[model samples]
Target: MVVTHRGAQAVGRCLEFGCGTGHLTRALVDRLSIADLALNDLVGDCEPHVMARLPAGQRARFHAGPVERLDPEGTFDLIASASVVQWIPDHRCLLRDLSNRLEPGGWIALSGFGQDQFGELQALGSSASAPGYRNAGDWAAMVPQGMALMATRQIQTRMYFPTVRAVLRHLRETGVNGNAQGGWSRARLQKFEQDYDAQFGTAQGLPLTYDAVWMLARKI
Candidate 1:
């Protein structure tokens, strides 16, 4: 959806925020004719992982750090992210800052988890670390007047796991386990399993919910 939205306009320099493991970066390269790509991630090693996926002779610059602290040399034609932004405490401010970095008419494509992103974990009292998830509707008011929000939508999907461990592993593998904190004791793990099974288990297995909100907006 992001690449398709970007393809609607003329794309030149693109900034891919949270280019973790280069998954989305690779997809963008495969689908767009971006003249330059700037890959940013909090993880230092993400650059090489994404760099390896670029087409032969393709070149991209890398910045590793919090997106808010990232200072690029110039404005961008597109600022895109996937499953990011929710981690940042102040997305309204973050979006405003990002909108300021766009060339007029440039596009922004972002996807983040809504407030119910981890509904199961949230219900299980296992995800109390951060409580600032925003739904697509919440964003309409936060958006700066100068920018126009377009094609925004939110959806909920459930992923089934054989056991609670698989859900834990999914969070770890996706690098979104910041909520796990400290460590899980045997007793804590047992309690978690019980709670999750009792509340969220289905005929398939344990169900993990993902509430994804995606939006396409453009600087005026």
Candidate 2:
């Protein structure tokens, strides 16, 4: 999405927050010629893993900390995060901070889950939802004054699993349900399975929905 707005040209400097395992980082490296790169993630251990995926001799620095605490030395041409901002509680403050860190005409591209993300799990009484989930229309209002909204996109999709247990395992393995509480007894697990099957079972299998929202803004 960032490449779509900034074109196929080179970016002078780029900053990417929540660059888990360098998925988006690798994508950006592949799609854009970023002269200098700064990567941030809350997990310090991920630094080696993210660095391993970068191109040989890539000019990059890894900042190990929550983005809120990061005090980067200079501005960036593109500040991007993928599936990360939803973990933040204050969207307004984060947006304003990131906007302030951008060079004029720089782009800020972010993607997060919408309010309906994991709707079936929420309906089944799961408290694993992220605090910053907002609908598609709500994102435009979150943009700071100096940034111009260039584009926004929202997608609703689902992945089917064989059973309720499988669905829960998928969430856990993917680290999306990190906040889920434990202590489910055999009876409780059985009841949850029955309820989920009755409520969301399809001819294919049990369904888990993902509501993804993406936004692009450029500093004026």
Candidate 3:
């Protein structure tokens, strides 16, 4: 979630591929004197809240669609995406596309949920015979060959809730579990809730952890 290192290099036209709520987009626009900027997200409406914070002159054009659909006519100075790549089916293609769309020596900064994200939840689900999840290393291995890896690291952040109900409620509100297909029946849902509480509940509260991976690379 934190930008560990950034260079003094100036960026001209920047594009944020998956600007979920535009939080990172706002920061980048503030940090760089970018003439043209593009913010894109699969769920187009999710960006309006973030767009409202920009000044009229700085407001960039918004593009709505999958990141893979973005057809860059020219190379950009910088491309940044935060916490969005994991959902994409072909991350390697996206990386290659970014490398192709980057001006010489352009920078690409990305952050995403690693395989270890929701480990406890995942384990509980697994033990209960739920679906499996992908690991971050799989994505890390798919980095484009020509891009020089400047830095790579994993981060873990924990969220503490007063009760298991609160934690589950947060997940529901955030649509974290919405990706699950073939909706569960009331009985199965009850079993899952019970299993999660039995496995992870604590006297004070429940501890939920998110594992994130960050990388910064430059086009060779």
Candidate 4:
């Protein structure tokens, strides 16, 4: 989605939120001719890692903290985030603030999870997931009047695990369900395995769903 929707666009200047080791940062440099690029993340160390991957001549700036705490102080040609906004608790106003940082004809590209993300875990009463979960239309509705939602889509992906234990391990490692941690008694563990198998089991394996939402909007 990033490559297709955001990669080909013209970018005079760009700002990235949640750069986190430069996954999207790498994509931006690989695809856009950014006159100047700014990468941001709470961890102060992301700058070096991202810069190491870009060409030597790419003009760049780095801000190392929550975006709200540090302002880059200029409108941008593009503002982008990938699989990051789901971590934010107030996505409506947060997105509005991000849109406000764009030039009139600039673009905003983002990917987050839908409300149905991790349905099985949600059914099991885990609060480990992100609080701000909205679908494509919900995002469109929240977009400010001056912006236009040029494209949006949500996809539901299921990942299967060979065993319920493996499923729990995956969540812990990925921090998908930070609340999934526990020292279950043998019986408690057994019960959880049984219930999960009975409810969502398949011949292939146990399934965990990812409801990915991707959008590309323009500040008209």
Best by lDDT: 2
Q: What is the lDDT of residue 165 in candidate 3?
A: 56
Off by over 4 Å in 2: none
Name the candidate, 2 or 3, with the larger lDDT value: 2
Candidate 4 structure quality by residue, lDDT tens digits, 21-137: 777888788877788898888888777887787888988888988876659978998899877787787776876898888898888888888988888878876554787788888
State each model's CA lDDT, in order. Answer: 0.83, 0.90, 0.71, 0.82
How many backbone clashes does every candidate have?
0, 0, 1, 0
lDDT of 1 by residue, 1-220 (tens): 6655545444689999988888888878877877888989999987778888899877689999999899989999889998887777887788899999999988888888788877788777785335457788987876786898877899999889999988888887767657754478999999989888988888999987788888888888
TM-score between candidate 2 and the true structure: 0.97
Residue 136 lDDT, candidate 4, scale 0-100:
83
TM-score of each: 0.92, 0.97, 0.84, 0.89
Tens digit of lDDT per residue, candidate 3, span 1-220?
Answer: 2234555545677888878777788788766677888788878897787688676788477888887887755778789987776666666777898888888878888877767677767777632111322354554566798877677768788887876557667776765555433466788867866786788777756778787777777777
RMSD of each: 1.8, 1.0, 3.3, 2.3
Superposed by TM-score, candidate 1 places the C-alpha of residue 123 at a distance from the truth, in angstroms, of 1.0
Per-residue lDDT tens digits for candidate 2, residues 1-220, read 6766669899999999999898999999999998999999999999999999999888999999999989889999999999998889899899999999999999999999898999998899877688899777888889999999899999999999999888878878888667764677899889989998999999999999999999999999
> Clashing residue pairs, candidate 1?
none
Candidate 2 displacement at residue 136 in angstroms: 1.8
Instruction: Highest TM-score: give the candidate number.
Output: 2
Task: Please give the lDDT score for candidate 1.
Answer: 0.83
What is the lDDT, from 0 to 100, of the residue 1 in candidate 3?
22
- Look at candidate 3 and tell me the lDDT of residue 130: 18
